[model samples]
Target: MTQPGIDAADAASPRRIRIRTCVATRERHSDEKLLRVVVDPEDFTGRRLLADPKRRLPGRGAWITPQLSALETAEKRRAFPRALRLSTAVDTGHVRTYLAELADGPDIVRKTEH
Candidate 1:
C-alpha cells in the first residue's frame, strides 16, 4: 500500500522544524529587566543572545540574563554552554557593548557612578 510517486520512506524523512523555549531571565538585585537570549529547543542546544523583542530564530531555545555580571560569570565558568550542552561561539565583546548601552539607560543607571 504505497503512493504512485511518493514512498513511505520519503514521508518519514524529517522536515525543517522550529523549537522554542525560555532558559532564564536576567535580573539585577532580583528586580531589573536586562536582556535575554533564545536557546535551541531540541535538547536545548545552541544559544544566541537576542536583542530584539521578537524571538524569531531557527532551532530550539532557552533564555539568558543580559547583564554584564551574569554574562561574565557565564563566560568565565562557561555554565551557559553547559546548560544547553552545545558550543557557544558568540563574541563576548558584543555582549559587553550591549551591557554598556543598558547601563546608559536611566532605568539601569539608578544614579550609580560606575
Candidate 2:
C-alpha cells in the first residue's frame, strides 16, 4: 500500500551516495591544492575504469587526478587507503595502472599530437 499523498515512483527510485575525492595537480596554484571528484555511480565500472567519471566503484572510493605528481603526493601522504578508510595498504601499482589507462585514452592521445 502506498502512503497517503506520497508518490510510488519516487519511493521506488534507488538512493544515491555521493563521495568526494581530492586529487592534486601539477600547476603551482591551480593544481597544487586538491581536485575534488564526486562519485555518483551505482556500479563499479566507472571507478574501476577511470575512463568514465560517471560510475563509481563499489565499497569506499578514492579520488585522485590523472597526473603523476598528484599520484606521487597521494602515495607519499598515504591518501588512498585513508580516503577508502581501509587500514590495510593499497597497491600503488594498481593506481598507476588505472591512471596509465586513462592517460592512454583517445582524448589525451589526441591532445598530445598538437
Candidate 3:
C-alpha cells in the first residue's frame, strides 16, 4: 500500500542515512563522524585541498577519518585526485593546517568525554 501521492517504491524505502567512506580507512561511517574536503580550483599554482569543517564547499568532496594519520595516509596514497575526480595532485598544506587546529580536539585525553 502507498499514500495517495507517493509511488510504492518511495513509500517502501527506508529513511536514508548520510553515510560517507573514509578515503584512508576504506570504511563507511556517518558524515558527522568524518571530515570532508574539496579541491580548490582558484589556487592558480597547483590544486589546493581545503578542509570543510562546516561541509559547505561547492564542488565534489571527499571524506576521511578526522586524524592526522588518516590525512597523511590519504595524501600518501594520492586519494584526493581520485576521490574528488581531479586530474592532478593537490597541495595538502592547507588541509594539514586545518587538522592541526583540531588536533586532539578536547584538552582532556583521559576521561573527559565531552
lDDT of each: 0.50, 0.51, 0.87
Off by over 4 Å in 3: 1-16, 104-114
Q: Give the TM-score of candidate 2.
A: 0.46
Runs in model 2 with CA error above 4 Å?
A: 1-54, 105-114
Better of 2 and 3 by TM-score: 3
Candidate ranking (TM-score, best to worst): 3, 2, 1
What CA root-mean-square deviation does each model show from the true structure? 13.7, 10.0, 6.4
Best by TM-score: 3
Per-residue C-alpha lDDT of model 2 across residues 76-101, encoded as one tens digit per residue: 88676556565665556545665676
* lDDT, ranked from best to worst: 3, 2, 1
Stronger candidate by TM-score (1 vs 2): 2
For model 3, residues 1-114, the per-residue Cα lDDT tens digits are 777989888888867779999999999999999999987756675489888889988788999998899998998899999998888878888889888889847566567667
Per-model TM against the reference: 0.43, 0.46, 0.73
Model 2 steric clash pairs? 23-35
lDDT per residue for candidate 1 within 16-94, as digits (tens), equals 4433222332323321233444453342433444443355655433344655676677677665565546675644454
Clashing pairs in 1: 23-62, 23-63, 26-65, 39-60, 39-61, 39-62, 40-60, 40-61, 41-60, 41-61
Which pairs of residues clash in candidate 3, taking residues 3 or more apart in a chain or in different chains? none
The candidate, 1 or 3, that scores higher on TM-score is 3
